[model samples]
Target chain A: MSETPDTLVEPALARTPLDALHRELGARLVPFAGYDMPVQYPTGILKEHLHTRSQAGLFDVSHMGQLRLCGRAADAAAAAAALETLVPGDLLGLAPGRMRYTLLLNDGGGILDDLMVTNAGDHLFVVVNAACKHADLAHLQERLGDRVAIEVLADRALLALQGPAAAAVLARFVPAAAAMPFMSYAEARLRGIPVLLTRSGYTGEDGYEISVADDRAETVARLLLAEPEVAPIGLGARDSLRLEAGLCLYGHDIDRTTTPVEAGLSWTLGRRRRSEGGFPGFATIRDHLDHGPTRRRVGLRPDGRAPAREGTGIVDGGGRPLGHVTSGGFGPTVGGPIAMGYVASAGATPDTPVTLVVRGKPLPARVVTLPFVRQNYYRG
Target chain B: MSLIKFTKDHEWIRVEGEVGTVGITNHAQHALGDIVFVELPEIGREVVQGGEAAVVESVKAASEVYAPVDGEVIAVNQALIEEPARVNTDPQGDGWFFRLTIADPAQLEALMDETAYQSHLEDLA
Candidate 1:
């Protein structure tokens, strides 16, 4: 279920009814997925990010992948186990209405994709990146086959209500939503519209991912946004928010050539999986976990206001190249520039000095501890 | 008498008495698409014509605003800082970014008038 963005118009690149709302709000619209989405509003990315941290932000994550995995009790459990074999996360213990973040791994232990898995009744509800959803499903089917049924829930939309005020704003629509614990999923009626509300989000802020039927998604979104605290945030704000929160972007931070361990996500691997060593590419993962990966992901703070964008070469003292920036931008919340990249594990310290070569200039940079801003996620 | 001035970078200046108002023409803001941030010079900062005066960053890119006439920044529209969308809202009215006290009144004659500036925008478009 993919659409070719090459054409002037592709119907599969679906449009949310709120498209008009964005234009009316003077959003800078760009083609993302198959639909036109606002990259940012007039307030700019930096301001939007700071606003989210100080208050709340509404994100139209409708383009995200939403799907359902169904099978008998024993079959579903087997499917979950098979999935767990690929990534370094525990899925078998995921109770219904609980969600866990994990990655899809290739046989070589490289990350194919990172996604969220939620236990919804007898089936597992999965949300992934729109661009990688097709490949992710193929990978799942190739491994699990008919033993577990997979259905691409094309009729659903995902909206991430993020930031400190997210709970307060959402509470007005779904009072029960405020009480749901973090990383847990709950089925609730949002203004009488059936929705899968999960206290999980990419932004480090306390937020919820509300999935609703395509027809009713707009209704629920409009209702939630009616609160004064909610602002129609765009991709630019979302990127900065995640960056400030230190969350990884799949293609940029983690890739098919990078294993989870090398990406500094070994913690996502359950303790049992580490001992059993039964998952695919377990040998390579265990080796990295035991001896440590040669390179690791770390946060970088650039000197001054100039942003060190992705692909910029990162270097050590004397201008010796070390790594490359994956994502870099002016962190609205941090009030400075920040970046993330893979650096030699030896030089990946909290205060290690590095330089980023931007436009033929060696800009001073330093490694800083992650989550540049403290995450305000509400546990409950 | 009021004198109008222009900067090669597309800023316009309209000097009335000792005070001058600086703004980016509708053409400039339209091309930028959704002004998100406007970094204005502090009041009382001295600047010369053709020198860097401020910065305007949009969602897609950033651009430097230039001084159209020699002046001392007397005031800045703080509203734009809190609501940058005003630039897109009214590039010539509520979008006017700052006012300056003319340091060299002679520099005003070098700018483009309404007719000339309109033609300049047409050529670029």
Candidate 2:
């Protein structure tokens, strides 16, 4: 769960294994989640965004926390069930090689973090947001210490190759990976390197997220970059791309005070869990689900050219304060200024006119059904 | 009767007689990334030296464009409204932000020339 950064107070900036490669590509490195990450490359954010939509872009997401959960008795189901207590996902029924997106909710139904859980047969592979990884790992340890062993996968680096032509480029290296459908994963050996390749990504594109050993990260990255369709994308385009997909950035959109239901993520909650109710904050979530949330996340498009930034107020016709924007920027694909914010549920419907108070000036904006653009995930 | 000067804030002023053309330096535009929108000053507005004159937004963030010297707003590049990315591709030539009528010629003395600005950039590194 990455947050839209307004400013930076760089502490001890940690470097990823691909740091040299990023510098070599003339990436503008900035402090993000305690890591010196590439905000953009020489190609610039707009071009990178367009490229990803039409072609492919490679993103180094090694800052994301990768972990493994092993049962004390070699029981994958037992481990998954134990994890179910922390998240609303029905992990106990999840088949191997399939993944489910879940939220780690606090007791009051607030999101602690959103993460992906993949049932890898023997153990569970989980990826959490970079800023929330430490706290998430500690939470897992305190909860499942007796039943399962939580091992942080610090030796692996994560890479995402995303866009329309991603499958063709990736297939050149690992032909088997081309057959993998969306949300499914398999362990594959490519170019003499073993990798865990998942057919999933954040950019609303058909792609794969590859987990490779730290030592061989550059080797795999070079092999992928050698493809004609793939280019190195920075966090700037990544933010814009995810925003166009109506995906929420962790701190900005959904925080400890925001519930998954309010964040428009009730779909992540499993049906069995919705009925049986056994996860953290289950009662509060159930109550919110039964009684519609007072406010909900909605997509906003300003009528003018000015980009409404994070924290811009959402107001009514009379300039009455309604809510605030959580994530706002120029979506290159949308060809206009786009934003996501929480407004009173009354004005959350599509085409509902509202004024976005930006820089003390109220500008015309309207609620739109999310995504703003079409998502092209591969089914086969 | 023309001269070029720079500000520590990364603005450039190209003086031609009583009128001065102003824009962000190429270095400044590069640092800002892709420019998405530009809010220009009105034609009759007066801008004080080092005061905010306009706003330039990029995919990353919004930055206030400060006037390098005191001047009266004369003209703005209307084409920039449709193609703000011009600030990145042609920051020096076609990307010139606004034309202003000089309020006081004395303000130019405090600014840096090309040599001094080049050294200033090196000093920042």
Candidate 3:
């Protein structure tokens, strides 16, 4: 677990794969998920955000957990099917090189963590959120350890090249990466280094997340940054970008107490899994889906300028307590403040008048459709 | 020229006789990533020394700008409402938070001058 830095005695923070490169590039490093991460570069958060939208921004996301589940080539189906017992996503139909965004669930239908599951040719590749990695690995170990091989790739570093021009920048290095569609992954070579390149990202943009050996991380990152269209992005703009895209940040939007249904992630539940009902929390998730969830995660667009931050009380027009703001911030692309939080289902409708109690004052806000900024994923 | 003074909290006051213009120091703005919103105090509002007078919201977090000395708010920066980014660009000038009628001009003696404030920042590091 990462220690919170106090004003006095500072705690030791781990460095990411590209820590030295980040310092050379003028990044303002901050502690995140037990690692010293660049929150923003000298280019600034706003510029990095705008640059990613217009061009491409490369992000070092090595702190996340990368794992592989392996068995015999033909028997890989068994490993994939076994994973279904924990997550509710459809894994049986996952073709080679395909990827799906799914959640790890507890027995009570609460989301343990959200992750990406890919069907590697002979095995399965999984990437989980950093903070929940230890727990997720332990959960899998206690559940399916005897059935399959769970390999932790601690020597791997993950990099996300995101934006409208991300493909163009990456194609210059690996032409094959240009052919992979969204939500697909393949073991490919970039600049002569073997890496797992995936056509997916959290920014709601057409992007590629490259997973390379930790030792070669700097070389890959520098090559990408060398592209005219690519700039080194930091965690600051990453949060803002994902916020505007209506993506959830673990430990904030969704936790062990929040079910996937309540978190607006029911779409990730596979149709077969919903009926087969063998996974953890299957009963509670199905029941909630059958009879609409009592509460829901919805987007909020404040009518005024003041940003209603996390933990701010969300109230109705009459000042009655409705819910609370889970994640809120000013979105540069949306050109206004955007937030997402759980509200009573009745108040979750878009355009519902609500008030965010910011600093004891009732700040006017309204429910808006999620993805405050529209997604630009490459479909073809 | 108005004599400029700074507080330990990183606020600056440009004292021009009985009136003073207040704003956050450049060092403070740099610390607060990007300034996205500014909540100004109401004109004619009474303020106590070192009390909350304004609010500045950055992309990272929100911070309260305090009154360096007891005073009555004579004017608040209206331009900040639409362009709060100005605080990041020119915090000590166009980003000035407010102007107030000094309730106790003698309190100005407690603030640090440019040289003293510069040395204080070094001590902090």
Candidate 4:
């Protein structure tokens, strides 16, 4: 965080393989998760956001951690079962080439992190958030080291080509990408550059997340950008897009203090896992599933243009405290302010009236269903 | 003749007699990105020089627009309520926030003129 004064000596920030490319494109770099990443480009955030919705947008998400886990003697079934011990997902039943979103919980049922686990036929591929990657790596090693051998893919870069036009654009380079089903993964060549492709994205759009070699990252990105339908997007638009998609940002919408059920992520808990109760915090999670949580995460739509920012207080019509906003901002797609926050479960019903205290003033708001905009995943 | 003066905080005031029109400078708007919301002070509210006067929100964050000089607000731009993008399109002309009765003309001397304000922006860059 840049909260420290400029006069004080700041720690050196890590740079991605595309650092020079970002600067060359006139990106305004800022400190994020210990990396100097681009927040916005010359096109600005508002335009970048709208562009990603209507057309294709290329994003550099290389700072996230990517790792591979293989069972001893290269047994993938054993690896999947070993991973099931740490997460609430039914990885053992997960089909090859399919990815499942899961959470890492502490013994107390509090969420430590959320990650995506993909069954790569012979091994398991996982992607974790940048800020929590180091801790996640340590936890995985400590708990499942004996059962699985973890290998960090530090030399790879992740890129996301997202939007309704993403499939068509990617088809020009790799024809198979256009036919891949949602949440499916494959390894293919993009115009001779070997890459891993996941027909999934954070923006709720039908797109692909590509993993390429660090040395070939810029080349692959440039190739994608050269397409007339694609534009370079930055972190600023990435945040708005995910928020509009009703996605949770780690360390914000969820943390060690909140549980998967409380975060409205109970769906990530597989049916078998729920009944078997083997993962960490299974008792508390099962309890929450049996009895509703005291507080629940819900979508909030402020009545006017003014956005209710993070940490803003949520109150009832009578000014009684309920909870505080975790992620809030203007949704360019919605053309108004949108927010997500925790509130008393009793008042979490859709269309329920609520008030947001922004800058000491009460702003009228209402609880609504999430994904303010419709999700356009490529189900076929 | 009207004269324009700027505060170090990027607010600009153009005086034409006792009433001065105030708004954030173009430089400020550029730094803030696209403007989405504007909160102006109530008419007839008295404000001190360098005190919080208005709020301008961009897609990313909100920023306070400080009063360049002590004054009493007389009129506010209602058009901003319907279309805040004016602050980005014409920050110097139609995007003015409010008009205030100058409480002390002497305060103008402390503000930076165009030449000084341009140099100030350069110093920041």
TM-score of 4: 0.97
Candidate 4 off by > 4 Å: A1-10
DockQ of each: 0.10, 0.48, 0.42, 0.43
TM-score of chain B of each: 0.92, 0.98, 0.98, 0.99
In the range A115-188, model 1's lDDT, one tens digit per residue, is 99887867888898877988888987887766678888887878888888988888887898889999998888
Worst 10 residues of 1 chain B by lDDT: B55-64
In the range B1-125, model 2's lDDT, one tens digit per residue, is 78999998889999999999999998888778788999998998999999999889989888888898898999999989998989888988899899999999999999999999999989976
Of 2 and 4, the candidate ahead on lDDT is: 4
lDDT of 4: 0.92
Q: What's the best-to-worst order under DockQ?
A: 2, 4, 3, 1
Candidate 2 docking quality: incorrect, acceptable, medium or high: acceptable
lDDT of 2 by residue, A299-358 (tens): 999998999999999998988877999999999999989999999888888999999988
Query: Model 1: which residue pairs collide?
Result: A13-A34, B5-B111, B6-B111
Residue-by-residue lDDT tens digits, candidate 4, A1-380: 01112113347999998999999999978778888888889899999999999999999999999999999755478889998888999898889899989998899889889998998899999999999999999999999998899999999999999999999999999999999999999999998999999998899888999999999999999999999999999998999999999999999999999999999999999999999988999999999999999999999999988999999999998899999999999999999999999999999999999999998999999999998999999978
Residue B59 of model 2 has an lDDT of 90
Ranking by lDDT: 4, 2, 3, 1
Query: CA shift at A297, candidate 4, in angstroms?
Result: 0.4
What are the lDDT figures for the candidates, one per model?
Answer: 0.79, 0.91, 0.90, 0.92
